[model samples]
Target chain A: MKTLKIIKIGGNIIDNEAALSSFLEVFATINSPKILIHGGGKLATQLANQLGLEVKMIDGRRITDKATLDLITMVYAGKINKNIVAELQSKNCNAIGFSGADGNTIISKKRPVKPIDFGFVGDVKKVNIETLQVLLEHKVTPVFCALTHDKKGQLLNTNADTIASELAIGFAKYYQTELYYCFEKNGVLRDVSDENSVIREITTQSYQNLIDDKVIVDGMLPKLNNCVHAIEKNVYKVCIGKPEMLYDDKANFTTITK
Target chain B: MKTLKIIKIGGNIIDNEAALSSFLEVFATINSPKILIHGGGKLATQLANQLGLEVKMIDGRRITDKATLDLITMVYAGKINKNIVAELQSKNCNAIGFSGADGNTIISKKRPVKPIDFGFVGDVKKVNIETLQVLLEHKVTPVFCALTHDKKGQLLNTNADTIASELAIGFAKYYQTELYYCFEKNGVLRDVSDENSVIREITTQSYQNLIDDKVIVDGMLPKLNNCVHAIEKNVYKVCIGKPEMLYDDKANFTTITK
Candidate 1:
């Protein structure tokens, strides 16, 4: 089977210009089919603050009210996605930007109001692999922003990490898919502050032990869980680390195995 | 040759929620191959005002400095483009949103600085007919925002009307293309103040007569010129006026022909 790589980059890389440029330069060199999913950066909140829109947060997840949804849609899907596409294009990689609504590639369900109504937040219900497969087969790389649609004409805010995982699993049916969660830190550090103390590999068996030891707490916990979820779903491989880990296996990063 | 309809919607319809919805309803019913190109709405300027970004104008044309370019990219490509795609998706149009960078569909040259320095504005240079044909052949309708990329990784502001005309002309080589400029006003009104005074058909001979008589002036002149330009470039038909004119012959609109 052909191999496909699904890479996700968080705000730490996106918010930094030099870092994003370096990352794209490396990303352009991957000859295998790949998809890039990016998160909304600090610009949304900064713009929200500038416009005096109160960002309501419950349990750390952003409340995507109509206003917030609009803001993030503009920031994530528009400015950032297109810029990344242009950057990749300049590097000779044909990159296409997507908000799940485009091509009806991803249809999601709005989170039910009974469960702490996250407003426009969505849970993935389906991924139309046909459109994505067409682009990929044509050697086009898709750059997706953290957004989805309900097919009922409403845009929904989504987690970029979940999008990466969903796409990896969805494509795994046809290709040997590897998922990468590329962020700023050296993956799954033994000590959060010590960048060099990286955990080399993690299995489901060892995951709980690490969690219990408090080595992977806070935000890293959900991210690690996403990696494990992808692995359980038959994704060929999953990793979390700095973007450089793509070309450098020796780079400090955590590999997730089933 | 196969037939293709290329439609452009200006700000008047886009700035209005009800009007845009009605327009999309009709646009979705276009059984033939079609593409929708939309102009940036007033929301960009409004948001810019909210963010205290001064919009500079030179000789009635907005100068697209870096900040303004970013603002429009967000509003036009991000918000307006995606929402339109979602609306069309709900209507079962299978819509896909694009900034020229996507699939490298439209590559443009940044306007030269010698000519009054329009900042990041661009002039259309090439259109990748292959990508558009691929989508159209698959029954996918492309929804484009008025922005193009300079191949070297820069997104530039472009005129929606020009983009519409250019695409129609580009596709005319392979398809009998009809171009529509849909806005709120009735087509080429004999009297600007009188909505009822719509010109039925405008050929090269009559167009000059109208211009000489001071009937077509201001913004409508440039728009009519775009119509004539597309017509001269062998486009099958070019129409300008209300969006409903798409299906209704009784609808008041102007048709341009050589």
Candidate 2:
């Protein structure tokens, strides 16, 4: 069986045209089956500002109100979805972009943060893995934006980390795939700000220690949680590293172990 | 047989909070079966501008590029999808928000426009009526955003008018529904600037005359085209009127006829 890989690219990668092009080149050369998920932080923030809507954040997570959620759907699922598709096509990669809402691939429930209602933010409750499997079987790489539909048939804004994690678990359980999370940082650093001090490996004990020490904070915290969850679900491996170093054994990447 | 209706609300309706609330109140009162489709044009365009992206428009239609498309997906599918769902819920109406990509409900092909490439825009090629039917059967009003997915799994930015038309035709064919297009304007005006000069009805003959007189130009062209297409497809009626007058017989609405 060909090993399947699920990877996530960040807003940093998509915003920089040069980075996007170079990444596409590398993406096209990869021979194994893979899936790509992406984020649109800068775009979302900028749009929120333009619409005179104040950007809301709850514990570093975007508070998706009615206005902000509309902006997000347009950017992530509509615009980013197609742009990524066109970019991959230009690079000779057969990439197709979609969202969690497509084919009911990701069924979510509204995340109503009590005392503060985030109008459209969602926490994924279920995933229709079969839908994703069908797409992969057709030999097309699926690119997903982190947006999902609620029980009421409404689309809600979801965190990319949450989306990537859920999808990793979904792919792992369904296809037994490995999950690799690629970002700008070298890897899981022992020192959060020190890129060169990459932690070689993270055991269940070390993972807990890092959280206790308050080093793995904000966005990275959810990502780490996802890694732990993926490993717990018996995925082959979960790696956190730079995009180019994803496949390198000697690269500064964190091997998350159960 | 119970009558089915597909009502499309414009951005202008949503922009006004009081008006939206009033409209939703009236909408919830309707005992008949109905589906809602909506747009967030003003919000999307404003966000596009703040992101340093030049809001590109060719003859009033948004010329969607990579960045713009991303903005739109985030707003339309993500944010607006949730708002509508929340509003309906507030009115105790069972509503679900969705994008065309969801459940493969709306499948499309990337429209290859020569000279200027509209990055992620698509023309509606097919619709999954069964999925929608099942939802409607369960008494869930599916609120749809104008975003769609291509066969290649790419999400495309589509015109709201096009989406509404295709959806109307699909619903009409599948469940034999009435298609209602509600906008800020009273109806199709005989004179562009006069609000009271609403055309009561438009037939194929009058439509041609309007086009010949250049009265039906710009954004109205696509809308008129969609109206004609729906009528041609044997929709019971394609009614164009103001949001508040949707249920009123004396409403200045135009009916497109063969």
Best by DockQ: 1
Tens-digit lDDT track for model 1 on B153-203?
A: 999999999999999999998999999998878888998889999998999
Candidate 1 interface RMSD to the true structure: 0.7
lDDT of 2 by residue, A1-258 (tens): 458888888888878888877877787677777788888858767656666778777766567777676667666765666556655655545565556665456768887668777777778998766645654665567788878776454777777777877887877755667787878888888787688889878877889999999878877888899888888877778888888775466678888988
What digit string (tens of lDDT, one per residue) describes model 1 on residues A52-144?
999998998778999999999899989999999999999999988998898898899999998698899999999887888888988999999
The CA lDDT at B19 in model 1 is 90
Candidate 2 TM-score to native: 0.63
Best by lDDT: 1
Query: What DockQ does each prediction reach against the true complex?
Result: 0.86, 0.15
Provide the TM-score for each candidate, comma-separated.
0.97, 0.63
- lDDT string, candidate 2, B1-258, tens digits: 457888888888877878877888888677777888888757777655666679877765568887776667767865566556656755667665566765466778988888667677888999766656765665667788888877454678887788888887887755666888888899899887899898889997889999999888987888899999888887778888897567776778788998
Clashing pairs in 1: none
Model 2: lDDT of residue B160:
77
Q: What is the lDDT of residue B117 in candidate 2?
A: 73
